[model samples]
Structures are given as structure tokens and as C-alpha cells.
Target: MELLNQIKENAKKANKKIVLPEGTEERTLKATEILLKEGIAQIILLGNPETVKANAASLGVCIDGATIVDPATDSNRDAYADIMVEIRKKKGLTKEKALDMLNDPLCFGPIMIKAGHADGEVAGAINATGDVLRPAFQFVKTLPGMSVVSGAFLMFLKDKTFGHEGVMVFSDCAVMPETNDKQLAEIAVATAKTAKAIVGMDPKVAMLSFSTKGSAKHDVVDKVANATKIAQEMAPEFKIDGELQLDAAIVEEVAALKAPESPVAGKANVLIFPSLEAGNIGYKLVQRLAGAQAVGPVLQGMAAPINDLSRGCSVSDIVNLVAITATQAAG
Candidate 1:
């Protein structure tokens, strides 16, 4: 909570404008109220204006400061549709199809970002991950030199017992089922940047596996090792080491016996898992068992600051994500 407060403070300074596509949902509506009251960011809500107003009124929430756009009736609908046609023309999208797609807020929200109508977008509280991400991939796309978009969680533990005083990053937990060495390297680089920008840490990245510094021999070990090398080559100034087991990466005593020569060993704040299965399982274990606050599966490598929320997220989660998105936009 302390770390989140610091992030919120930083976000407040950014004063970014964030669009919420799931505006009609109760959690989103409630979160918007806090965002407005706190002056966290300029808020835009996408939905039918009448429905949104009615819902907020009944829920005793005030959206006086928010801009509500009814995509169905907004005058910009045609203009946005035209923009989509131009952007997606190479993929065989026609004006008719673009107009149809614009009817959905999922598509419309990202289109708004690409068209410069908003700084960033947040959605998926009531939508699937694909519904939120597919449009972003088509509209916002990836940043320069990035091959794929990945997801990471900023794990904030209560005790400073491990990994950069209890704040660590776990990557590829929500996207990319499988990644090659190059993709893994990209994930490391991107995760490091996220750690610095969002978590306010100088990142020490660990490419994690079941082996420690070539102590075990396997193709999977080699993949992680190669990825570490590529990541180091990509960011020569960043501190990174790899092919380490979880213990060697975060446990000081074990690191001394296993990877004594590695700078990132036992002090790593950013962990890059070799596979999605491992990453997902690892984060959930820490989140559930360790009682750590897992904020995100925040989408990284996008050209803009668009994010996806878990469908089961709470109002607080929505609020925190807005702050994180705002900070990203600021950067």
C-alpha cells in the first residue's frame, strides 16, 4: 500500500487523461469518482450518455468532471470509423466493417487513443483480455524495436526479506505462451523499464529457470542462458544475469553458494520467467501464499499507455490501474 501511494503521488504529478471503456460498470463508475475527486487524471467515460448518467445517479456517484461519450450517437463516430479504415486498410478493413467495429467500445476506445482524442485507455473489467488487447495491437501497435507485447506484475510484499526490499517484478505472466531467446530478451528489457518507471526501482533482472549458472544441463536452461546474453547485449548498462533458480535469484545465502560471481543474483528485482506457465504459477503462488499485492499484468511495449484489467477486479484495482496508466502516459 505504501508503494502504491508513492506511485499515486507520481501519477498525480503527471495529470494524464485516461479513458475508461467500461464506464457503465459499477466498479469503474466508483473508481472514476475517486479519480476525479483526487484530481488524479482527466477522465473520459465511454458509453451511452443516458445510461451512464442514470447508473451513476442511482449509485450515488458523481461524474460531474468526466466526459461521457456515447459512441452510438457521438458525432465523431464517422470520423473515428474513417480513421480506422485508413489504419486498417492493409488488413482488408473497409469503411463498413470499420463502422461496425466502432460500435463496440473495446474497438472505439483504442481508436480514440490512436486518433489523439485521449492519452490512454483502460478496459477489460467486463471484457476478455483479447477483447481489450486485439484492438490495441491493431490500433496503438507496439513501440519501435519491440517485437511483441508482454504483461508484468509488480509484486509488493510486506516484509523486505527478498528481492529489492520486497518489491519485485514478474514478467510474461499474462501474455506470450511461449517466447524464444529474442522475445525473452525483449521482455527483460521492457520489464526493466517498467520497474524503473512504474515501481520506481533501479532494476536488477534475473532470467529465471530451474537451473543455477549452468549447474544443470538442458535445452530449457540454454534458452534462458542465451536470453540473458541477448538481454545484456541489448542493454549493456542494465544489470542482468540468468539461468538461475528462484532461490539463487532472491535468496542471499543460496546465491553465495550458487552464483557468487553474478551481480544480479540474490538482489534481482525483475524476474523473467522462461514460459507463461511458470510465470503465471509463480506470481499466483506469491500473491496468494505470500499475501503480496500483485498489481498488474500491466501491458508493456505498446505505442501508447493502454491497459487491461482482470474481469474480477475491484474498484481499488481500477483506481490503481488508472494511476499506473497515467504514470506511463506521463513518461
Candidate 2:
């Protein structure tokens, strides 16, 4: 099925309230339109009201004024500040800092969700990754039973080499800089849950590394092995294995030669990396160099579905992430 179809179906089920920062972008406005027309969400757009209108007019897109939430005109500003101060009382927030954050777009969006004004948020179409994440940590928080917030990419491919055509999830690419065995295990299980929730399938997770099984010896090898053990213990129902190279995890002949006993080898859909460097570089290599359409660095393990978009993302990208965010919120 097409990724957009999955998104539309999820949006119908979730009916989430979504907040968009820097809502004047062509893609952002178009996404807002789709969300409303499809009943996928009730959206709040952030920016100057007139400016948003003018931009939409310039792009030949029209947004209902009632749906746009201008921070400058928001009557709930002080209330939002109070909520932010309350949530970050331990973070050393003073009344002044609280007010400052409430005025900031980054903080305001998540604060809206925390205060029940919105169900989820989608940002980073024109912001940095950290700019997107800082507010999420401050307000949205980690999901219950989850540790630190980590992330993954939903890689969209042209061919259905795997059971599902079009896309598969690969995670921990955006959050963890260098994950230990326990962290990797958490990433695997968390990603599996994310896949199941959004894509509606039990994930076969592959803990990918430079070596397969006992053929290689190093700290990294030990890390993958330990991660495999932890993942099995934490989510035994998930099909998971580790220390397999890329080819071995996804290719049939490689699985036969390298690690024939592994359940996930050659059949894994979600791939976990030992470090952020590898995850980021690996995914980019496939997307840019090896010819695949990479859709996300979707933030996971959060209390709600909050996602970041590339600054250069198109209207379609924003629409897709909003769909993903709605699904996350529904769960």
C-alpha cells in the first residue's frame, strides 16, 4: 500500500489535534488543508494571521482563519506559561523564563499539547532537530515504561523486496549518539512497538552491526550480542537478533552463510544501529547514494507522537509526518 494511504487511514482513526509551527510554508498549509478536509485532524497553525493568509493566497491555498492559532493573539498565553513553569519546576524555570518559553514557538507547541489544547505536534520543517526536540523534552515527556527519547527513520523504497511494498522502519538514527547494549535493546523493542502501532504489523527487528554472530570480535560485537539478549528478555514475542551485518540481515544468501540460526536474519524489517553515526550515515547512504526515498527521523519513546521534519521538506513530507504524529497520538 502507499504510505499516504496508511497515513490517511491512521488519521481517520486517531482524529488528533495537531499543532504546526512556522505554518506559513506552502507544504505546511497544504498539509493543514488535507488534515481538515479529510477529518484527519483539527490543526492549529502558528504565525501571524495576516502573514499566513498572504502566503496562502500567494500559493493559491486557502486556510480557515478559525483553524489558525496565532501565538501573538493567543489569550491562553499566561495559562501556557503557568503550565510550562509547572512542568519544568525542577528545570530551574523562573516566571520570566516561563513567559519567555511560552512566547517561543518551539516551547508553545508542546505546551499546547501538555495543557490539553492539542493532541500532538509536527515541527522542524523550518527548524533544527535540537530546536524541535528541546521543547518535546520540556513538555511532551517520555512515554510510560520508556526511558530516554530516541528516534528512527521510516525508509520508503520503490520496490516491495520485503512483504510490504513502499516502506519499512529503521530506528535510533536521530537520538542516540552511541547506544550501549541495553539502550540498543530498548531501541529495538521500542521500534517494534512503533511499527506495530503505525504500520500494523509485528516487526522482525534486526540488530545490525559490522559483524555477524561470533565471526567478529570487538567491543561492538559484544555490544550487539548483549543487546540481542536484552531485547529477547524484554520482548520475547518480537523476532530479534543482533551482530549481523547489513547484507546478512536483509539478504537471503547472506543469512544462510553468515548466521543461519538467527530468526531475524534475512527477514528483518526494522534495523537498529549500534551508534547514531552509523544509523544516520547508513540511512543517508541508502537514500541519497543507493536510491531510496527516506521519509523520517520520526521521534519515538515519547509520551505522545511528536515528530521533526527536515528544514527542506516538501508539502508532502509535512502531510506524511502529521499523519504519523496523529497515529502516535492515538496510541
Candidate 3:
């Protein structure tokens, strides 16, 4: 499906409030406008209200100050502390700890979502991944069935190279540095489910490695093989395979010659890497060296949508990620 069409679908389903941590950037401000104007959901923008409005006005974007949440305001502090305390009760966080979070406005967004004030959050437009994720782990935590929070990058392309006319997802590139077979399997399942929700299709997942089946040998190769098996067993309704090289995973001719019997040999829409080193370097190669628009490093497996924007992101980067996060939340 087209990117804008996907965004429209997400906007249609969003009914809960969404929070933006750093709402001062041009792209984020514009995204806020898109959300409000589309009537997607109620948006709570973090930062000073005057500063946010000033930034939006300078960017030729008009944002209503009343709709934006200012954590710095005295009126919000007491409520913020109370919300934090309530949400962090499971973590044994004390009143003092909750009060301390009120000092930093960054903590307010995720905390608000955790406290039921908002349904989801979109952050990291101007912050580091660590900063964007800290609050999520502190409050939002993980979904009931998920143990570790993982991430995936959406590769939107219009090239003949992938031999397809659609976008796809590649995962574990930004989250888990190293994963066991179980974790790899879980990543594949989560990524596939995400694909189904956003793309409206059953994802064909390829657990990518340097080897094609048993053509090569290494502990890592075995991990991919085992992960593939686990994923197949866990998600019997989904098509998946592993121990396949990138070429065999995506190239029709190569896949036909390599693993002709595998259902996902050539038509995989999602790729799961066994290690963070491979996932990170591989996606960067595709994005920077191969000319694909890498829309993520988008965080997955969380109960709510909280994405980490690259620190060097541009205004457009912020816009796309906000849209991606909204899609995640809505779906």
C-alpha cells in the first residue's frame, strides 16, 4: 500500500489520545497539525506552550496552545506527580521518585500515557534513543505476551531492485543487540503481526543470515535455523523461513535456486536478523549505500507506540516517524 494511504487508515482508527514528547520541531509541529486536523485523536504536546506555538508559527504551522500540554506549568505538576505515582506503583516507586520526574518535562509524556491520561506516545524527535526509551521502560513496560521490547525499520522503496512494488519491514536492527533463538522467534512473530496490522497482509518472514539453509556452518547460522523453526512452530498460520542469505531471501531467481520449496524464499516482506550487529549494519547499508528510505528503527513489542527518532533527523524525518508511530498506535 502507499505510505499516505497507510497513514490515512491509521488516522481513521485512532480514537485514543496521543502524546508527543518534543513538539517544537517543524516536522513534529506539522505532524501535530496533521493529527488534529484529521481528527485522528487528541494530541498532548510536550514543552512550553508559548515556545511550541512560537516554533509552529515560525514554521507556518498553527498549533492551538490550549491543546498542547505544558509540563512546566504549575497547574500540571501536581497532576503529573499523582499520575506518576499511580503508574509506577507496580515498580515500587515512591512519592519522592514520582515528584522528581515532574522536574524534567521529558518524563511527562510516557508517564501520562501510563497513567491513562493518554493512550500512546511518540517521542525521540529531538532526543537520543536512550532518553526516549527510559521513560517507556519505567512506566509503559511491555505487552503481556512480550518479554523484551524490539524494533523494526520500514523500508519504503520504488525501485525494481527488491523485485516488488511494496514496502517491507526489517527487524531487530535497533533494539536487541544479541538474541537467543526464542527472542529471535518472538521478534519475527511480533514483526509479522505488525506487518499484518499496518500493511493488511500476512507477512512472509525471512530469518536472514549469511548462509542458505545448511550451505554454511557457524553458531550464528544455527541460531537463525533454530529461530526459523521456532517461529514457524509458534506462528503456524504465517509463512517463515531462515538460514537464508539476503540474496535468497529477496531475489526471486536466487531464491528459486536456493530454497525452492520454502514458501518465503523469495517473497518475504519481513526480515529478522540474528544479531544487532547484522541488523544495524545491514539496514544502514540498504538505507545509505543502497538508496532505500529507512523510515524507522521504529520500536515494536511495547504495549503503546513509542518510537525513537534518529538524533540527526530532519523535519521530514520527524514527520514520517510521527506518522509511523501513529500507525503503530492505531493499528
Q: By TM-score, who's the top model here?
A: 1
Instruction: Kindly list the per-residue Cα lDDT of model 1 for residues 108-179, writing each as its tens digit.
Output: 899889888898998989999988999999988999999989999989887787766789999999989999
Ranking by TM-score: 1, 2, 3
lDDT (0-100) at residue 111 of candidate 2? 82
Segments of candidate 2 deviating more than 4 angstroms = none
State each model's CA lDDT, in order. Answer: 0.91, 0.82, 0.78
Q: Which candidate do you rate higher for lDDT, 2 or 3?
A: 2
Residue 308, candidate 2: alpha-carbon lDDT: 89
Tens digits of per-residue lDDT for model 3, 261-294: 9888888888888888888888888888768888
Task: Write out the backbone clash pairs for model 3.
Answer: none
Q: Between which residue pairs do clashes occur in model 1?
A: none
Q: What are the per-model C-alpha RMSD values against the true structure?
A: 1.0, 1.7, 2.4
**Counted clashes in each candidate structure:** 0, 1, 0
TM-score of 1: 0.98
